[model samples]
Target: MTTVQATFDSVDPATGEVVGTHPIAGPEEVQAAVDRARPAADWWASLGFAGRAERLGRWKAALTRRAHELADVVHAETGKPHADAMLEIILAIDHTAWAAKHARKVLGPHRRSPGLLMANHAATVEYQPLGVVGVIGPWNYPVFTPMGSIAYALAAGNAVVFKPSEYTPAVGRWLADSFAEVVPEQPVFQVVTGLGATGAALCASGVAKIAFTGSPGTGKKIMAACAETLTPVLIEAGGKDALLVDADADIDAAADAAVWGGFSNAGQTCVGVERVYVHERVYDEFVAKVVEKAREVKPGTQIGPITMPAQLDIIRRHIDDAVARGGKALTGGTVGARFVEPTVLVDVPEDAAAVREETFGPTLTVAKVRDMDEAIAKANDTTYGLGGTVFSKSRGMELARRLRSGMVAVNSVISFAGVPSLPFGGSGDSGFGRIHGPEGLREFGRPKAIARQRFRAPLVLTTFARTAKVDERVEKLIKLLHGR
Candidate 1:
């Protein structure tokens, strides 16, 4: 008897055309990939920061040179506009470059003060790789989002096993193939194409760590699986993020940002602006400008099809529920066979599903608030705390600080994600553990602390030879140093 491999086809959401077919990786294959990554991780770590940086630079160059080719794959799989795919690829390249160049400075061994108690000892700290890291990516923003973990992990001297979202496996494979072109000697970055079963296999494969980006429910499942082996995990779950427009905000700019932030990627973005809270003073003017701009956004050209087919039903249900509850649609309110037009709802109750849930589609719910205080309160009321935006020239920072989210953009929309130096993640239901920047580099590694005695102190405290007189002297020293 011969074994038959099970496979699945990825289809274009807009036309329902088959994009590509990939084999489903079972637990055995997933484990095998992890096994291969172990030795590769050791060798990669042995190369030191400088050596790894040199190789990563080549990989970055490969991504940059053939960016258009990868963008084509992204566009075909996710139905996102070609330009949107390219933008994500560009940001991923930038992050790769930053991680490669700054790994040494961020993770290399550095000196530390020994403190008064251990004055004669030389202390130092450094971050070391944890061998193999597993990355489970999302279909939305697949390239840019997962690279937050993959690039940083590789830079910190660890091998990676990536399991791309089933909807966008081709994009994931493209990334791994590009990387292999530069570093073929080892499986430094490998991809396993499959569904949730494959991701579950990775979590249980005993990799040093797992970085996951998906729904909070799925994130919880991943965390539970990793907990079985005491393996650490990082999760970047979806969010019900909001955009706030203060009374003094630039109405035209805020409207532009709101429309773009809510409708881009067919509103499948994890950090997309799903809700808008505007000051009552300018609510009418802002809503008018938003309606004008939103009407200009053409489907299939400006907004793409909803990548996941199941999301269409959710989008329709939310619109129907909001309307049944007396909310009015100022622009659009219907879902098509493959696409959802930009839908803007007003007068929806705060407890409505459209307001409280993560309707990952091209929709926005705008509400009026008396002042910034109410705006902040209403914005922070959601269970998800991922990313937020404030359009206040004078109170941007003040309002940003009060929003209960991991990242906030003042006077802009989702600008923090574009900057490679900023750490990205969320709290509460949005999930925990960061990826990107110094924190991201450190997230993939474990810290090692070292201390060496340079000279013996007269009042030794670690041995059994200490006398009563020494104890009294130590007490006096502690009092002198900390009594104040």
Candidate 2:
């Protein structure tokens, strides 16, 4: 049997050995994969909502049945805890279900005002499928994150070509393969496994839209590449999200949330709480509680190894820079061979790299602010606006609305992901466009307005043969409507 050499090996990180090998597809192969999707897209779009919904139902059932197997793949590849992986899969299933169930209502035809002069014409708007969608996924939360785009696009009647994070290509393949089992008629969904080059290829391949989730720097490059073809894009980039604690907030609850939000998935989440701004009155108490809670969490016991080995150096740099700049490491600030200590640094300079940049590891920097205004200002200072959390008894909703983020949790952290009705994306350097909710469904489809003539108008404006009398009547009607 002929064999292809491995592209890259998936290491156990804790052991640093090759756990599996994945194929790295080149540009030509990537283009071929996208090209193969055209016919499938036509057929898939032809099926409309009912057909797509039925197939999605079957896919959901398959995913529910094989949830454990998929979770194992996720854990093996990303090194997250099994329970965490299960949580990610379950949330992904929820998003998939929401997309399937709501696509029709969200994308269906709706009545629109025709204006006074055009009252003789009936107008309506509906969302039409964009044919093929390209989803470039991230390794962190491999299932949950990518499914945000995959499920919505499929629900909107678009065929999808997913480029999973190179580290977790197996999980992507598993998903596509499972979908194929349900809809064997065509390649309505496909996976192209490779590195950044494959992702760039997809951006340049003329897909109607590309949904990307990664770092801000990479997101810029992806947006630029997509612009070459005028292809629209939805970018869920990195975030230096903050969790603000009010004077009357529950310090213990805030501490618990901060620890989990910061350390879970080895701190690889874009919406991970990397910074905290507490009211000065409760600063000392909040700091003590957070440190105590953070101490209870340890790398490899509560968290997992850094999935991508190179991120270790970045994490180390952030910690070292904070410490060198007179920041104090309250709990863990050390790096192991493949694992990073769950570091919580306080008294860090505001300009420290740890406070200003994305560490992408198990670390957080907390600061004290005089009031909610200062807290809001500090939280909005960063260019990222992916997600944030606010812990305030009297001002939870108010603070959440004031934060310049895509999604905000009032009393909790990461609850927006569970709602499935709220849109998820970011602003500024965090990137634009949305995923999840109705906005996500519309992102994969194009608006199509259909207008028909219901009766003969008193004044004929569309035809060139209109007489002076008709023109005068139209002018009179416009004046009567606008009172000009």
Best candidate according to TM-score: 1
lDDT of 2 by residue, 193-309 (tens): 888988999998878899999988899999899989999989888899999999999988898899888988889998889999999999999888888888888778678889988
lDDT of each: 0.95, 0.91
Residue by residue across 1-484, what tens digits does model 1's lDDT show?
A: 9999899999898899999999999999999999999999999999999999999999999999999999999999998999999999999999999999999899988999999999999999999999999999999998999999999999999999999999999999999998998999999899999999999999999999999999999999999999999999999888999999999999999999999999999899999999999999999999999999989998899988999998899999999999999999999887999989999999999999999999999899999999999999999998999999999989999999999999999988999999999999999889999999999999998999999999998889998988999999999999999999
TM-score for each candidate, following the candidate numbering:
0.99, 0.97
Off by over 4 Å in 1: none
Model 1: residue 96 alpha-carbon error in angstroms: 0.5
Q: Give the TM-score comparing model 2 with the true structure, all chains together.
A: 0.97
Error of 1 at 375 (Å): 0.4
Residue pairs clashing in model 2 are 332-343
lDDT of 2 at 73: 88
On a 0 to 1 TM-score scale, where does candidate 1 land against the true structure?
0.99
